[model samples]
Every structure is written in structure tokens, then in C-alpha cells.
Target: MRENSFEHYYTQKPSSSLETREVTIRLKNGNVYRFISPSGAFSFGKVDKASRLLVEYAEVEENDRVLDLGCGYGLIGITIKKEHPDITLFMSDINERALKYAKINARDNNITAEMRQGHLYEPWQGYEFDVILCNPPMAAGKKVWQEIVNKAPSFLPSGGKLEIVAFHNKGGSRLEKTMKEVFGNVRTTIKSGGIRVYVSLKF
Candidate 1:
């Protein structure tokens, strides 16, 4: 299926006319976050179910270095930082507009994080993290997600983890398999509303 040009949130530069709106979300933990959403960012005004689920259930340890790959509008990373203040948070997105808003949201939320703009792991080359969380761009195509899985191991140390979320029937199963293939083990740590969060450990 060919996705419309406007729907390609994975693009480095979005062609959609830039428009801004403020979004406030109250998560299950009773924490509220504010974000500046712009046109062309994924799930612009609201956090999608899959991402919300990932934010609610993705595991992070204190003092761990974390990367939110493809972090749209900084939701996952920001929420994780709020929950685990001790963990160092890093966010990167291919979408320039999204990255810009991510920085603003971090500031609005009173969180400090290292922000970078690049495709996939490009901005973080030579850097390793204790955990990597992603709501992979399924709309971008299998190859993109495959690269995320295959290349993730090298960016993590032994016992480091990669956690990802997707709908079970809609590429989640395939992503699980790829994680297992690359990391040699995978586990479903949480599932809700047909979305599953898969965790893989680098061993």
C-alpha cells in the first residue's frame, strides 16, 4: 500500500504546512504532560494507543541511559524521564519539526535531555545506551523496522534491552521474530488493546 506523501512522518522534512497546537495528556499514573504538536508529526494532537501503552509499560531502571528512537513529539522519552528521573533520557527523530517540538516539550515539562535529529540511530553513532524504546514506524515499511531491529544490538551492551510496541497482527509478530533473531531472545512484557510491547535483551 502506497502511503500518501503527507502521511510520511518518517521523512526528514515534512511538506505539510506547519501548524501548531498545544496538547495535554493525563496518563494512568496521574501525571500530566504538555506538548507542542505541529502539522505532519505522528499522532499530532494526541498520543496514540500503541505509544501510550508503550509509555505506560516500558521498563526503565534508575541511572540507565535510555534512547527513545523515533520519538514523535517526545512523548515516550518525556514520560519515561518523568517517571524515572534518575535515568538519562535521549530523544531523536528524523522529522526535524518533531525534534524541534520535542525540545520545547522537554523544557515545558521541566525535563532535561539530549536531543538530536537524524534518521534512526544516525545521530547517536558511537553511543551506547542501557535501554532503547521505540514505537517503530510501521507505515514507513518493513525495511525500516528491520533495520531498527538488526542494528539495535550493536548499540547496546550485554544485558542492555530493546523494547518496542505494535499491534499483534499488524507487524508486531514479525517484529518480535526479528528481535529474537537479532538478540537471540525476546519477551512480551505487556499487552493491551491488541498492542504488545516486546522486550529483547542483548546477551
Candidate 2:
């Protein structure tokens, strides 16, 4: 595995040495969560800025069926579930190490969520969600992110929303364009520090 390769984080069986660490993130909703992060997962040290931005801007409703696609260490889904306990949350990731930590985080937080290990949308076939949250794997390249934007509408019902966070210079514009083409409308909910949160409704 190349150093800094995002694909390494997507591996089903990671060969990297395990270095477990704890991370506490303060959310926009004024709630703080502590999670255990292993070395092989994405953002092992702390919650990444894009995920923070996504959690800040994305809307989660009570009783909403939510999917946190590419959930790394369960930050986005766990935080949302923490705030909206009535919602049904499903978290999926390709990385086994990330999924293990996500499970640990969910248990530690007393949050009930379905955690699955698979590529985007694979584990949720024939299922749909009222809202989908993602801090896309930008390091995995545009093809992966574009697939996420393209297939999102199929997994969402009418009026369902898909929210994503990406850096402005690094595929953000392209993702925004693809989102517009797919969802018919794309809105920038938040943009700061070179990162933008783009949201689209499946109307």
C-alpha cells in the first residue's frame, strides 16, 4: 500500500499496524462525542473538517431513515443519531477497521445503528433512505465520488436529500455539476476553509 493512498483505507483486510486512539468531537448541535479510532481508518487522529462541515449542514429529521455512506469511525451517523434518536440510522464502509471502530463508537455512545461493510450502496440494495450523508472519499478519485452522486437518486425517495462535503478545488465543482445533472438542483449549504457542503433534493 502506498503511503497516504486512500485505497489503503478501503481495503477489506488492512495490513497496517494497529494504533488505537481516542477522539472527541464537539458537534454544531452542542453535543460532544468520544470515539475510538484505529490506525488504518480514515481520519484516525480526529474528525476531519469535511465531516464536521457535513454534520453541521446536513439536515436529519426525527423518524427519518438515514444512511451515512462511507461512514468513517461513525462520526456523521453517530452524531446525527445522537441528536435525533428517533431516526433510523445505517452506516456503511468498505474498510473493516473503520467498521470495527464505528461499531465500538456506536456502542460507547449508546446509539443504535446498522453497521455494514461494503462499497457505496452495495449493502443497502432495494432499500432507500429519507436522507443520505457523505463526506466523500475524495482521495479515491472522481469516478468513485461521481458514482455516489449518480446513483444517489435511485436510493432516495421524492424529496429525499443527499448531502456531501468536498474541497472546492479538489473535485467539488465537478461533483456539484454532476449533482445538478442528476438531482436537477444542487445547493451549496456551507463553504469555508476551501471546503463546501453541497446538497441536492430528489424531487
Provide TM-scores for the models. Answer: 0.96, 0.96
- Per-residue lDDT, model 1, residue 190, is 91
lDDT, model 2, position 56: 75
lDDT of 1 by residue, 2-92 (tens): 3763256778898889988888767887888878888888887776799889888988998999999999789889988998999999999
RMSD of each: 1.4, 1.5
Give one digit per residue, the lDDT tens place, for model 2 in 153-189. 9999998999999998988999999999999999998
Best model per lDDT: 1
Cα deviation of 163, candidate 1, in Å: 0.3
